[model samples]
Target chain A: MASLIFQIVVDSLLLGGVYTLMAVGLSLAFGVTRIINFAHGDIVMYGAYAAFFAFVSLNIDPLLSLLFVAILGAIGGYLLFKLTLDRILDAPGINQVLLTFGLGLVLQNVAVILWTGDERSTTPSYAFDSWFLSDDIVVAKGRLIAFGLAVAFVVLLLAWLRWSELGRATRAVSQNRAAASLMGINVRAMYALSFGLSSSFGTATGAIMSFLLPITPFMGFPILVKAFAIIILGGLDSIVGTVIGAFLLATAETTIAYVVPQGIGWAEGVAFFLLVIVLIVRPTGILGTVGRDA
Target chain B: MNLSRTSVMVALSVFAAVISPAPSRAEDTIKIGAPLSLSGKFVSYGAAAKRGVEMAVDIYGGKVGNKKIEILFRDTQSDPQVAVNSFTQLLSEEKVNFLIGPIATPMAMAGLPAWRRTRALWVVPGATTPLLEEEAGKEPMLFHTFPYGYYYHLALARSLREKLGPGKTVAIIYSDDAYGREHLPYAQKYFTQEGFKIVAEELVRAGATDLNPVLAKIRRVKPDLLLGLVQTTDGIQLTKQVYVQRLNIPYLVGTAYPQLKQWQDASGEAQEGWVGVTTYIPGLKAKADPKYPKLFMDSDVWKAEFTKRYNREPEFIDVGAYVSTCMLLIAIENAGAVDDKEKVAEELKKLDVHTMIGRGHFEPSLGGTLNQAFADVVVHQRVKGADAILYPKEFETADKFEQATYAK
Candidate 1:
């Protein structure tokens, strides 16, 4: 029982790392742009496909090709924002939502046409490798690597936000768009830059997930739904809250699955239940300011 | 001037193509409606079935006697609602008496009401769950060409008992979807009847990314065998996660997925020693049907022909669809190439050909489906990137069951 508990804890933390990567970008984009980026999950899926193609075609490991994939994703996201979202910045929120949602559908269909909806994954040697911590407990190497990368990415993002000039300017825009504009800061440019960076993180998450999860066109929607829930739980605009929400959701799911009968099947429903409780208790979420204003 | 002319021509072509409906069938043509999931989740099944149907048509020379055969295919988009719409449109609008496909079980169930309205001579190439059988089994025109979920467990339990002996504990991990839920009771009944104690019966969300929670729980029980009842996608995830978790169970069993190339490719090292039940594996040697040599050729011969066209080895659905379509087309030919679905249905019931998947003949199923074919399935194991058939006493390739690679 102790070993099982330990295993559950280990699994929860690792899964939380994945969940954090899934939600952080959405939180970042929403903090600054306030657009919700309904297609964030599809952006992550594109990253996964990019990593997959790189791995299969060039024999590049997903981890190794992640840098290139992120850069490319940043460029693509920037272009997409400039072309579509940029034009609809002042449109009704419902219209913006529909556009991004439609964009996601288009991307998903294009992927299906290109890849034929077959389940695929990049098989690095470490994908099947594991470390036995004890007689009864084990840690998967691939997931451990994903957890490490996610931590590193989040830390780097936080540091950039805290210290970098461009990052500080972007945060200022997110904190007060009108004031930042009054201070002669390029608010639109910040939004564009933030969106690009968010997409970069999304793609990077996908590259890591190429080994951890099945690479399919439809894989994004679930990731998107979970990430949306976590961000809402953490506060839509709070990266810290998102991280906390991810871990909390993962722990709750893992514990329930280990302790209760038929728990994994109910885990997802329990996640929504948690979201409902959080919403009723704190409408602005644990740390969100946007929902309070709304 | 040339560029402008070329642009105008391109615009004209695109407009024409967009405006055109599928070429209308002539009065003398035999129209067959295929409502399949051509896009979205179940696209793999639909794509394979399309390939099979097309290949069968090509082999049949695109005509039955003096009449050209016309097939109208509607995409179901893998959604139940969409399947209903597709079936309704095909049956009501097209009004073709003959119908085929919409392969996955959920899609088939979705089309049930629409199908009953028209009562066309429906041929279902796939739908492993007994849901369809229970609902439409008594219908005279409905022909099920795949084995029900119970048959899979019946074969699996009987074969495992023969190899591992009685009293071995079993752990079954089933999905929460209809496929898993429907197969669970049958799995329980059959495995228990075979003298195995089911130590753990865990339910998982169909497309869950992480199965470690279930794995952690199952690890404690430490059953002798782990049976995963999931579709191909989940099967890959379970197989990979099971390997990573290093569950020490000696044997791993799956329903229908271990034989799939996609599962095999995605599973990598985790595929070994996993037992699966299927109607078609690449290596089941079968003889050609004597009367219809061209249509129902030998297994290897037909496989080579299919591979040559599709540029990949055939999976179970591909062969199932191909065999089912071929038999239907042949029955039409045998019925003197008429549009009378009743005469065609009678000819189909009379078919007794030795084909790739097994005897292609309609008989009453054990589950009470009046017209069922391909009830015979093969139990096989994945060993060294190849399938080794086991069971049925006649087609047994290896002498004994092999332990999983990691366990060994």
Candidate 2:
């Protein structure tokens, strides 16, 4: 029983790391622009496809190609923001939501047309390798790598936000757009940069997931739902809160799955249940401020 | 006065022309409605079915005795509501006398009310779940060409028991979807009947990323065999995860996925020694119907023809669709190129020919479906990137069952 509990803890932590990667980008984008990029998961799907093509066609490992994919994703995200989200920044929230939602649907359908609904994966050696902690405990190397990358991503993101000139400017814009504009910071440029950085994180996460999950055109929406739940639970604009929310949801799901009979089947509902509880207790979320301070 | 007389003469001529039949421009034809999921989650199945149907028509020369066969293709979008609209459009508005396709079980179930309204001679090439059978199996017009889920378990339990001996223990990991929940009871009933003790039954969420928790639990019990009841996507995940975890179970069984090239390709080296049940594989030896040699040629020749046209190898759904469409066309032709569906159904019932995926014949299924075809499932294993047939004795390719390579 003790060993099983240990395994569950280890599994939940790893799962939490994966979940964090899924949501932190959404958190970042919402932190600055306050408009949800519904196509965030589709961007991740495209990254997975990009990594997959590099692996299959050019024999590039996803680990190696992730850097290039992230760069490309940043440029794409910048262009996307300039084209669509930038125009709707001042529009009604529902209009922004519909625009992003429609954009997501378009991307998904285009993927289906380009690549038929076939399931694929990148088969790096690590993807199929594992380490045995004991007779009863086994850790999958693919998931461990994902967990490691998640930690590195968060650390780098937080560091940039704390120290970098561009990052500080973006944070100032997120905190008070009107004040930041008055202080000579280009508020729109900062929003664009933040959104681009968020996209980079999303694509990087996709590269990690290319091995861990089945790659399909339709693989995005379910992920997007989970990410949305995490940001809402953690605090929509709080990076740290997003991380906490991801871990909390993962822990609840993993514990329930391990302890309850046929619990894995019920894990999909955990996010909603957790959201309800969080909303009841703190409407703004665990660490969320109601106003514009991210 | 002369201009008015000319205008009256022209008006009378136009009226005569309008009243007369316009040289048969509508044309004599047979209309068939195909509600397939051409663009959504079930796109692969729908695309393959589309190919098979097209090939059957092309090979059959696109006509049956002077009537051009017209197929009205409707995309179900892989949504139940869309499928309902598709059936309504085809059955009610277009009023097609023949219907086919919508491969997934949920899509088929959603089309039931619309189907019941028209009662057209519907030929279904897929829908492995028994839900369709339980709903419309007794309908005289409903012809199911794919084997139900029970056939998979029936063949699997019998074959595995014989190979591993009667007392070997089994563990089942089923998905939480309709596919998994529906197949679980049958898996239990058959495996228990075969004298294998079921040690564990785990339920997994469909499309889940990590299957480690379930795998870890499964490892503790350490059964001899692990049976995964999942569709192609989940099957790929389970297969890869099981291989990664190296559970060391002597046998790993899957339902309806191991034979899929997409699954096999995605699974990579992890596919070795996994047993699965299917109605057709590429190498199965079958002769064409002696009467319709051009349409129902031998299996290998037909496969080569399909590859030449589609530029890819065909999956089970592709083959099943082709065979089903061919049989329906033949029945239509045999019914003397008429619009009488009752006659075509009767002719379909009378069909008994040697063709691919077993005899082109219809009989009652074990699950109480009145007209089921391709119920004989071929139990096969993946060894060194090739399939080795194991069931039905006559089509056996390998003498003995092989354990998973990593396990060995």
**TM-score per model for chain B alone?**
0.93, 0.93
Which candidate gets the maximum DockQ versus the true structure? 1
Q: For candidate 2, list the clashing residue pairs, or say none.
A: none
Report the error of model 1 at residue B243, Å. Answer: 0.7
Write out fnat for all predictions, comma-separated: 0.83, 0.79
Candidate 2 residue-wise lDDT, A1-294, digit = tens: 999999999899999999999999999999999899899999999999999999999999999999999999899999999998899888899999999999999999999999999988898988888898988788888889999999999999999999999989988988888999999999989988998999998898889889888899998898899999999888888999999999999988888788888888777686579889998888888877654232
Q: Is the docking of candidate 1 incorrect, acceptable, medium or high quality?
A: medium
Question: Which portions of model 1 miss their true places by more than 4 Å?
Answer: B1-25
- Give the per-residue lDDT digits (tens) of candidate 1, residues A94-209: 98899989999999999999998898888888999999999778889998998898799889999999999999998999999999999999988999999999999999989988
Candidate 2 segments whose C-alpha is farther than 4 A from its true place: A291-294, B1-27
TM-score of 1: 0.96
Task: Give the interface-residue alpha carbon RMSD of model 2.
Answer: 0.9
lDDT score for candidate 2 against the true structure: 0.90
Clashing pairs in 1: none
